[model samples]
Target: MKDTGSAQDAEHEVTMLKVISDLDADLNNVVKFHERVDMSLYDLLEQREWEHHPLHEIRPVAKQGLGVLHTDIKPDNIMFVNMKDQPLRVKLIDFGLAKMASQVELGMEIQPCGYRAPEICLGLPFSKAVDVWGVGCVLAFLYLAQNLFSFKCEYQMVFII
Candidate 1:
């Protein structure tokens, strides 16, 4: 006989989807559908003028000025914090691939292909400078309104850079 567990799982997923749809439809103005703010830097840059800010705001460095590296520094990971009655601020997030400078080894995979620094792509030892390079790429993307290196593979990204 066929496995009944998968059938039950599919039924459960459908039920969950229906519940979520009902909740989405019943939400009030405070939680209206399609009202989510596009907080990502990539999206915000499309509608607003470029803001001049210090690199320290990105927080690529670790606590106490330790040499920590936010290996993945794409625009999607950066967010704009719009505070009521306060100036707009930026927050860098998604440190899932972060590592200390001393921990990174040669040829270790880190950043996304589009944002990968030259040193990392060349299989050389790297440090926080890689994060700086990533920031530069992101800044170029913001000013140009497109990705500087939109490649599917590291080889293509390095070749273009």
Candidate 2:
């Protein structure tokens, strides 16, 4: 006999990253970290030229890619599971807020409370880095056992603005 939920959970678990590869961002005319921060840091990325990249020929949403962005990456979505006779493995769960990395705009709000990334918080166009940022927040929580930027609400997360 086999367990049904185990099989379902195995299929349902969201892999942290389906693939891993070395990647680099355009630096010649980067959005300049400070520049992005300088803009209305409190506005949603979609409200501004969030796609302002260094490439003059390529618009932000031009080259649609195959990567998936998990905009909502709270601690509850990550968990460690141990299967019988198998080593324990950590996995990311939930795809409710997942979106194509190349999506120009989403009707639904991205990210949740304290786990929101800077780009998401500012309504700035974002990429895979948003997921990385969320994971970094998770790592910080695991390391320190406390929320880094504890906020009662998403609107309350304006540390810069």
Candidate 3:
């Protein structure tokens, strides 16, 4: 892919990063400590590879416009919650930019500043992958103690990433 100039889709990369993190944690179960607090990874990926099931889980978004998304998946949205007789739980909230997959037309930019993915910047069609990017970004944040792919002013963030 050619180098697309500027931050047209600034937050696009953020969600993809989150996806990567989720995969990493699920595959490796490698936990990292941030500020002495145990930051558990997202438990999204299934232990078994997704096979064709009689009743598949992933279905096309309904025409009524209601798909799955926690659009603005930044660190702030990742809240640590407490439950009865259970360890700390992670809750992802703030679906400000969320939209049904069927409703998500191509070229509609999303995510927060500094987390834009390349596809978003390039104005390509996006889907559930955006959430993965967000989760991967969160995992990176936990490990790096800083925003890994956050662009400040220019698009240098992409180069570094």
Candidate 4:
């Protein structure tokens, strides 16, 4: 039973990855860079009417070779499900905030509130490193079972900025 569950979980993870990959590819193809302006995920989402308005633009770079930027990669966006008796697998959900990066400009800023990188917080141009930072945070939560940065008040997250 455990073996069966494990197999299913693996299959599910693969499926989710494939979906993300496809979406990333599509986003990459549609978004392109220009001399004057960098296209952000928020712009694409807003243009496509994914939502009435763009949410906080987060990481704008494509990381892990994924074509699109997962600007919002909070723990809630990850879905963990057990397959039979196999180990749990993670599925990235909610692409509503994702964007294509070939269009980002020099002055644009994007990133989540807490998981945001120092460079972004300082209003500097960012890259895939933002996603790497978020990944690190997620890993810490998964493995260490704690937040990457701690604070008494949520607003204190700015200190790390």
Candidate 5:
């Protein structure tokens, strides 16, 4: 029974490798794989189109248009969905911390320590720009495969930044 299981595992591994190789060969320019499927803000930035979802206009950054401040923009909050045949699409999840641009207050604690913007860290008045900062951190993490500023504490994060 042990030998049979081992053989099956080996066979599956080979099959996976072959599939990966075939995929690599098929795409001359395979986008670098990120856990979030390499989703970029380019489309959101350049197109500046907003979906009619119940959520806010969801524009890129601030002052560009009406947008919500996804205060906790992190890799874990991003998900690739609708992947069955169509090009990969991502949806920002976990809006528990989200606030409208007009609703956000000064010195309100938001965003993870590492992704927190300097203004947020310093208890200064902040706006949707903090969300942009969080997105920048997420982008850095996706590209580098690790947190751009990995720190155990907010002080360390602020110092590193």
Candidate 6:
């Protein structure tokens, strides 16, 4: 039974690796598109095409835009393959809390505690920068092998409120 569990884990790792590789390839394509078109983030934000848009309004942009900004990036949401060696590949999972945004807005509701940025913490509207902040938290966890935020109580309230 133990061996079976190990085998399953190994298979899961392989699957995650493939997913990460595909994600990396997709990101590269997005980067190339940005370079070729010379579209700046500032320009995207100022387009005025998405003001007062719901979170779903930005999904199309995220699908066609410059990167998969996992807004809820966290250690538990990311799976690392072959971590014992160098060049470890990571697969990001769980988009339940993800929101695609081109510009920062005020009064936008988003972010989880610990991984949440100050803007989000302050209840300000967020942009793709929120995802960058989450990624930073994930990286810190990877390097430290521990959680970036250590909340003892009211953790769920943080996400709910």
Best candidate, TM-score: 1
Error at 89, model 1, angstroms: 1.8
lDDT of 3 by residue, 57-132 (tens): 1121000111355466665655433333323344444444555566677787677755666666667977777767
- Residue-level lDDT of model 2, residues 57-157, one tens digit each, is 12221222225676767656543333333222333445545665655483446777677787777777667776767766655554445566754766666
| Candidate 3 lDDT | 0.48
TM-score of 2: 0.52
Model 3 quality (TM-score): 0.54
Q: Candidates' lDDT values, in order?
A: 0.61, 0.47, 0.48, 0.49, 0.56, 0.46
Q: Which ten residues in a row have the lowest lDDT in candidate 1?
A: 24-33
Error in Å for residue 133 of model 6: 1.1
* Clashes by residue pair, model 1: none
lDDT for residue 97 in candidate 3, whole number 0-100: 56
Query: Model 5 residue 48 lDDT?
Result: 34
TM-score of 5: 0.57
TM for candidate 1 is 0.62
For candidate 6, the per-residue lDDT at 102 reads 45
Residue pairs clashing in model 2 are 43-122, 44-123, 45-123, 45-124
How far in Å is the alpha carbon of 146 misplaced in model 3? 0.6
Q: Which stretch of 10 consecutive residues in model 4 shows the poorest summed lDDT?
A: 29-38
> Which candidate tops lDDT?
1
Compose the digit string of candidate 6's lDDT tens values, residues 1-161: 36887676566555434444445534432221112232322222234342332444223223222243445555455433333451223334444443335433577655556677767666765667777676666555444444457433235435543
User: Where is model 4 more than 4 Å wrong at Cα?
Assistant: 1-65, 81-85, 106-109, 150-155
> Whole-model lDDT for model 2 versus the true structure?
0.47
Per-residue alpha-carbon lDDT of candidate 1 for residues 55-159, written as tens digits (9 for 90 to 100): 554343121111357687887876554534323344555544667566789999889888889998889978788887887888777656677896487777877
Write model 5 residue lDDT over 1-161, tens digit each, in one string.
Answer: 36987676566544433333344421322222332343443333223342222213222111211156667676565544434443334555444455657777888888988889999989999877887788677666544455678546998888888
RMSD of each: 11.4, 16.3, 14.9, 17.6, 15.9, 15.6
Descending-TM-score candidate ranking: 1, 5, 3, 4, 2, 6
The true-versus-predicted C-alpha distance at residue 111 of model 1, in Å, is 0.5
